[model samples]
Structure formats: structure tokens, C-alpha cells
Target: VLVIAIIAGAAYYMVAVQPFQRVILSVGDDSVKTGYFLKRMVASQGMTADSVLQSLTAELIIRQQAAAMGFPAVTAQDISDYLRNIAKGENETISDADYDKWFQERLDTTGLTAQEFNKVIEGEILAQNVQDTIGAQVNPQVPQAHVWIIVLDTQENAVSAKARIDGGESFDAVAKEVSLDTTSKENGGDMGWQVPELFSTQISSVIDTLDIGKCSDPVAFSQQDSTTGTTATSYLLLMVSEKSAAMQATDAQLSQLKYKAFLDWLSAQEASTEIVFHGLNGS
Candidate 1:
């Protein structure tokens, strides 16, 4: 019985403990390279393994767990939807095949397989869903407004423009003839459908105090033009065209907020989880 027990212990040590130790030691020896790899994986919320074989095993485990939970597996259609959303945000376009090839190339560069990458993506989606569930309770409504603005290079110009408007010159004509924001000048300085939150609290307060169709006193704003590499202070004349009541938050938006809260909770949970590193000697 003693000999049998010894043999069983030897087999377990050889099969599991020995290999795990060897690979971990190798990672420690190449700590700089391994650290970079681990950092990247951590940033993406991916499991890190000391070797490629361990990485493959970890990926399989993640997939199996996800499947057991009936987590939606990413398909080509899902990838396409993801890409389309990204393109919409960036105002760019790429063919589906092109995106697929590019994605594969990135995985290869990062030493990740399709299954591993898919697992990471699935985890992200699940986390988002969890957040959505938690944030759903807060119904936030953002007030929308239509505004007309006249921007001038200096406070003096702003005061002069306001004086001219008060003197009965047409606001639209004055904006077109002299306002600095050329993009809005053609449309009579109309900035359509802006959320009140888009402006600073002070600016929003000022706008809230003014009645619709009334022009404001000159307000100073500082900005930099990246293209021209120019920095300047400007004064603005704002006219509120309309102020609409805040729109109720949709279910989807509420879910998104919940998901953010869940992530915060998850971070705290991780902090409390135990972590053990063997053979590093606190290095």
C-alpha cells in the first residue's frame, strides 16, 4: 500500500506539477519577454500561460466553460456586425474578407489562435451584458436643443457683432458675413440637435436661463486649431432656437450603464481573489 501510494504520487507530480513548474521557470528566465506578453494579455483580460501548450489548454477550457453556459459563440456574421460598427464610428470601410484576413494576421502576430481570440471576444460580450443588466435601473434623459452661434476672434469682435444684431441687422446675414466658424456660417450658424450635456455646466446654465430665440451676451471660449496649429481666444454669441424636453433613456442604454457598474464590481472582486506565484522568490 505504501509503495502503491508512492507510485501514484510520482505519476501525479510528473504529469502535472513537473511540467507546470518547468514552463513557469522558463517564463521566469525570460522574464522581460514574458512580462511584455503577460502585460498585453492582462490588458485584454486574457489568461496568460507560460507556454504555447498551456495557452492552448487554457483556451480549450475557456471555450468549454462558455459552451456549457450557452454563451453565444462568435460567427462570421457576428464579426461582420462588429466590424461594421467599428467602421461606422471611424467613418471607414473595409471588405469583409479584408477584415477577416487582417484579423487573422493580428492573431498570428500576437501568438493567439482563433479559438483563443474568440474566447476573449466572448468574455467581453458577456461582461457587457452583465453591465447592461446592472445599469438598467437608472433612466437618464438628455435634453436636446437647437442653437445658433457666432464665433469671433476676440471679445471686441463678439461685442461688436452683438451690437450690430441689437441695431437690427439680420443675425443670419451677420453670421455669414463675419463669423469665424465657416462650416456653420453657410447654414446661418445653426448647430442642430445638441444634448445639453455637450456644453460646459456654466455654458449649459447660461443657455438654460435664456428664453428661446434670444441671443446671449458675448461669452469667451479658448480653443486650438489642430490643422492650423493656432491657439486663440474667441467670444461667441449663442441663440437658442429650440429646447426640447429630455428624452427617456432606452432599455439598451440602461443596460450599458449596468454593465459599466458590473465591471467596477468585477475589478473589486479580482482584488480580493488569491494569487500564487511559485519559484519567483518574490522577484
Candidate 2:
């Protein structure tokens, strides 16, 4: 009986506990074990499992790319400095004893050991470092397009609107009469100076490529119907009235572009990197 019990326990460990230590997410050669992902799910209160997985994936990619980009390494001292800044009084850093007490409380609340929590802090540091580095590259002046749009409920309407503009009818008059977009329609379809990143994927793809004063063909956009849970497609006709090679970006536009730059880099990394998901759904 004793021998049988020991064998059964060992089998259970192999089936259950061992799998948690196995890699579940991989980016290049870097990986996150299932155990670490679960721990993060616990630490990240109220986040869904899928969201936790995404956060870990982003963190791994950031750490990997940061190293390749020659960004400064995060150290134990750096973690301590982060703690000190947070625990500082009006004039001075917290004393060692107080710092210890606060740190212990944090660990107790999060249910993570020092090592795991330090890894979390290191992830935060690396993310902020990357964001700052990317943001600094966004210049105050960037290429922009002065655009007008006519939003219609169907492709036929969009095509007709484009034809009207092509056949010497005033765009502003047609937009005022037929556009479904109330705000732009009220403004004579003027979108003002715009960055492509601020629009939909379809619109952005053609916005920079269209010649000045030329109208685009119908561009389709899809949205889900909230009441009936069905997808509905709409169409838009775009005309680039002017283009600027170096238009000044507003603070809001700069912030948006900076964030987009980070996402774009991450997307490129994901495309080039060999990322594999394993052991999910018991496979």
C-alpha cells in the first residue's frame, strides 16, 4: 500500500505541478513559464487570464528588445532606488527599517516573494525606458495631410459621393447633404491637418498615398451592432486637399504618435520573432 501511494503521488506531481513550471509563452529564445503567468494573474487584481498573458508577452518582448537596443540593465540597486523614491518622506528617503516594513507589507499583500516582485518592477522599468526612448524620437513637425471625408451607410452612396466630387460638384455641399458623420459634415467635411495613425487601418493605408486634391474610392469600415450583435459595414470617401511634409504636431497628436510608434515596433518584433504558445488547452 505504501509503495502504491508513493507512486500515485509522484504521478500526480508529474501531471499537475510539473506542468506549471513548463514554458507556456515563448518569444525568440525567451519564455514565460505557466507558474509565473499565474502568479502575475494573482498580482494583477481583476485582470482576465488572457490579459495577464498579453501583459507577460509584452514584458518579455520589451526586456528582450531593450537588451538588444543596448538599454541600461535593471539592477537590484535600481529596484531599491525605485522603492526609496516611493517610500520617501518630504525631505528624505525612508529609513531602512521602515523600508523593510513597507516592502514586507507589499509582498504580503501581493503574495509574491522578493524575487518575483523585483521581476515585476524590472518589467515596469524596462517598459518606461522603452516608451521614453521611443517618445523622444517623435519630432514636433511631421508629414500631415489636410483631408475631407464623406461617410455613407453603403458602398453605392460612397461611390456616388466620389463621382460627384470628381464631376465638379462641391465636396462641402455634398458632405452637408449626405454625410452620416455629423461632426465632419457640420464642418464641411474638413478633417483638418491629420496624421494617418489617427484613422482606421483602411483609411491610413491610403491617406498618405493619395495624391493631393484627389478623392479615394469607397473605403469600408465595419462595426458590431450593439443591440443585435451583428456586424455592420459602412463606407467613406476621402479627399486629400493638401499635404505638408513638415506640419507642426499638437501635443495631443505627438502623444498619440509616440504611443503608436511603440505599438508599431512591438508589432514588427512580433512579426519577426518566433513566438510559440505551449501547453495551453492541455496540449
Candidate 3:
């Protein structure tokens, strides 16, 4: 029985422990071993063997699918650019020594070789490219609306502005006179034609419920100050002028759709692929 088990283990290794095999998450002619993922996940994240294995499996699936889709490969320059971006901070210039030390520390902590780290970066860039490509292709007919907006720094000012509008003042006039968003204020607060997504979900949901050419009462939301990293509650008012049932998708919206599309595609892959998770519970 012992000899038989040893032979079975060797056979499993021969079949599944390769980067170009029809096992685990093979795509076209590529695969990854269970050990390969376990090493990186355990070393870098301090994750349990089982959890790391699950993540690694999902990661390879996406990368392999991206490769199969013929997405552009990550270049050496791309890796360098990514490292440089990592070294950047809000207001600091990282020296070469510091960057090198930081990079090595990450490798030491994660139990990843430099080559392995490069491959990881490459996989990320490729996956992003795939997502962008799909998103660019997604042309969801987005609903659009025309509205006048008034943004005030203080609740007292917002209440005062609402009072003026309630007293039969023009929303356009009020917005242009007191709005804080300089660009929109210049246009008399006219947001020509916009998707509901132009604002936060709170504002958009409210807009969806308003009647045509109707005004929304002052709604409160918070804005973050980048320099100070502080949040401030602000007030907003909107008056709808026109709307469309569907229009071209914005880049931001397209980005969201693209990720969804990739997820859907990956799910489809799962259906057709043969995956065996040895020793993983409830897999």
C-alpha cells in the first residue's frame, strides 16, 4: 500500500505540477502547480494553505483566459513602470536604495523570487488589458438627463438656497450665483446631458424618482478633501430640465461593465474546464 501511494503521488506531480499541462488551470498550453501558488500565497500573505490555494487557482484562471484571448503581454518596461508607481507617495521622493529595499522586503515576506514577482505583475497587466478591451467593446445604452445643480459648502446655505427656489426663484440663477463647482456654475449649472451615474448613487437614485422638470430638495452627502484626507458633509440641489432613456456609455460606466463581462466570461470558462482540487475541503 505504501509503494502504491508513492507511485500515485509521483504521477499526480508529473501531471499537475507543470506550467504547460492540461491540469489545474491550463489554457491553450499553460498551467500552474499547486505548490507554485502555495509558496507565494503562504510566504507573502500569511494565508492558510487552503485559502492560498483557492486564490491561486482563481488567479491562474483569469490570467490564462486573458492569455487565450490574445491580450498584450506585459513587457519589462511595464514591470519597471509598475515598480516606480509603487514607489510614489503623496509628497515624497523615494530613493533608488529605498525602492530596492522595499522591493526585496516584499519578496522576502512573500517567499517570491524576483522572477516570480515579475510574472505576477505581468499577469496583472495582462488581466487589466483584457478587462479594458472588453469594457471598450461594451456599449451599454446609458440613460441620460439634463439638470441644474447647486452645491453648497454649508447646510445653512443649502437651506437658504432651497428657500429661495421655493419662493419662485430660478434654479439656474440660484446655482450660477452660489454654486461651488466652478465649471458647472459657469454654465448656469446646466449639466447638458448626463447619465444618472454622473453623481453618487444617492443622488442618482433620487434623480430617477423625480418627475420631469421637477426639482429635488436639498440632499446631504460628504466629500473628501484630498490634501487633508478629511471628509466634509455638503449639500446638493438638482433641477431636472430634460432626460433621455438611453445614450452612449461613459468611460467610467464602461469600465464597470467590462469587469462584469470578464467575470461572466470566467464563469463560462469554469463550466467547460476540468478542475480537480485535491485535499481542498468542499471544493
lDDT per residue, candidate 1, 1-283, as tens digits?
9999999999999775554344222221122233333434544444434443244333333344445546676676675566456544565677767677777765776666766555456545554544455455544775767778898988888999999888888778889988999889988888776655546666777777778877789988877896675988888898888887886545654445455556555545435433233332222
Model 3, global lDDT: 0.74
lDDT per residue for candidate 2 within 1-283, as digits (tens), equals 9999999999999988887878888878888888777788788887888788778888889999999999989999998898778877574768889889989988988888999998889998898899989989978788888999889999988988888889998888888999999889998799899988678777888898888878888999998986676998889888888888888899999999899888888888888888778856322
Superposed Cα deviation of residue 186, candidate 3 (Å)? 1.9
Off by over 4 Å in 2: 1-5, 39-52, 75-118, 197-201, 223-231, 281-283
Winning model by TM-score: 2
| lDDT of model 2 at position 182 | 88
Q: Give me the overall lDDT of model 2.
A: 0.86
- Model 1 alpha-carbon drift over 4 Å, by segment: 1-103, 108-142, 223-233, 246-283
Clashing pairs in 3: 19-31, 44-110
Candidate order by TM-score, decreasing, is 2, 3, 1
Cα lDDT tens digits, model 3, 1-283, are 9999999998887666543232333433445554565566667565666666555656677777876787766789899778767766553677788888888987887788899988878867776776677667766887888777889988899989989988898888888899998879988788777777656789989888877766688899897897676999888888888778888777766666567777777678767766665442121
- Superposed by TM-score, candidate 2 places the C-alpha of residue 90 at a distance from the truth, in angstroms, of 15
Candidate 1 Cα deviation (angstroms), residue 276:
21
Q: What's the true lDDT of residue 201 in model 1?
A: 69
TM-score of each: 0.47, 0.76, 0.54
RMSD of each: 11.7, 4.3, 9.3
Please report, as a residue range, the 10-residue window in candidate 3 with the lowest summed lDDT: 19-28
What is the TM-score (0 to 1) of candidate 2? 0.76
Arrange candidates by lDDT, descending.
Answer: 2, 3, 1
